[model samples]
Target: MRADPNLYDYWPYRDRPKIVWPGGKKLAFWIAPNIEFYEFDPPKNPSRPGWPKPSPDVVGYSQRDWGNRVGHWRLMELMDRFGLRGSISLSTALIDHHPEIIEACVARDWEFFSHGIYNTRYSYGMDEAQERAIIEDSIRSIQTATGQRIRGYLAPALTHTERTFDLLAEYDFWYTCDLFQDDQPQPLKTKGGRLVSMPYSLEVNDVITYGALAMDPWRYADVLKRHFDQLLEEGERSGTVMCIPLHAYLVSQPHRIRAFEDALAHIAGHAADVWFATAAEIAQVYREQYWDQTVADIEARGLASGGTGFGPAED
Candidate 1:
């Protein structure tokens, strides 16, 4: 199948504009605590199923609900103890269903951004108008609840249509976590507006680590340490972004919390080497200082041609 032309450019990582994070640090670090609300019996999308099994999946729903009720508080307390502020990937409907969670996060001055109306909702199979409505709903819901304009988006259940990026730019969203194209922030080629893709982890995510990879807590911790260590080394040459995407139900589980805490502590120990910042902070800085320069540099390198060529064959 031919690749869609509207997505983004083909700038490689080997040599690109070097990003210097604030505080003269090598790596910019952020934590994303996905505060979600999974519905008990949500509508199914034609393109994808909501529940793994069937509707009225009480076990699945309640288990995820556990995150909001008990697990999130534990995770928040731990983050507070470590002096780490959260950049929340929120399900906007929670403002109505679980205002207490929103209040708690807001009280900490955490950055709030949309993950869509609810975790159970999917963006797949949505027409352009439907998708635009969803984006509007998220913007209005979040603005009403938190009194802040959302600048970032991580599509609900990581689902999206061809038009998602362009629409986000049209609606004034500054960054997206959906594109996992690089370790550093990169410009997205939207139709006629500005948008950048921030680095959001799938590899080091608690859900992927424990659920998909089936790794234990300690193994997950080891993975975090190793990932941080290598990125820290490479970042000295050029700044890199490291994100730990978390789900409270997974990482805040009693058996898993200590190991995850240990990993955060290890990373924080090198405070002088990394810029621990919110996603908004990173995006704002890049937009102001480095975005135009980065676009110019990519264009200069002849990387924006968007051809299918993979360069010359290996010697």
Candidate 2:
């Protein structure tokens, strides 16, 4: 069977039901700091290249390594300054190599979720057994080290197979950051159980803005402010979610960190209007209050028959 191209129902954004966040807040704002670890000479997958240049690329390896060694701390300090907590999209092996960084995040009461064992590792071309083992490794390693059961996943480098969602549900994951289709949480069509697609921004992400768009810090800051402004305004009528995806290597440089901080300050200033939340927290509340209604609305619109789940709910 072919996959559904539109992951969710065809609900027009303007006409959808208003989502009222707790405390009548307009926006659900969260930060995801991608605390990653990249191996210098990773095993290759048929679907994707491990590095842009070649194996043992010193410049590429060291640049990403700097995020772990130096840049992450600088980014964490600024998060502290704004009293913001991160939901870390972590590489599982980082717990072994840089336990101190994980320890610091734990101390700040931040949430940790799997981004696979290594940033260089891709989910492409994996069989069901291999994928399941990776999920189990992540769950076990994180629980053993940090004493928290991870409930979210962002596929490494955003690579995934059809079974990815099914496996995540079986392992009891609550949310996924892989889908960029909506500005609000939506029920996902997984096989074993329920999953929520959290609003994770690709456009506002540091890697895209800095690397692909060639945006300088000043322009980056402006774009962030503008993104927030539009969302805040639209959110007054219905609740919206905004995520700022950051990589320590890209945003934590001395030249760029201050501008990023300034943008954070601007968003933080509107504390009364937004609820600063983790992805799990947002998913939990939506599951409790809105999931059934959303499902029902999709059904009413005649758009709920396209999923590939294992049971009768799927077509």
Candidate with maximal lDDT = 2
Tens-digit per-residue lDDT, 1-315, candidate 2: 444544456666776777888999999999999999999899988887899889888888998899889899999999999899999999999999999999999999999999999989999888999999999999999999899999999999899887788899888999999999889889887765678899999999999999999999999999999999999999998899999999999999899999999899999999999999998899889888878888888888787777454434445
Best by TM-score: 2
TM of each candidate vs. truth: 0.95, 0.96
Tell me the lDDT of model 1 at 235.
92
Q: What overall lDDT goes with each candidate model?
A: 0.88, 0.90
Report lDDT (Cα) of residue 105, candidate 1. 86
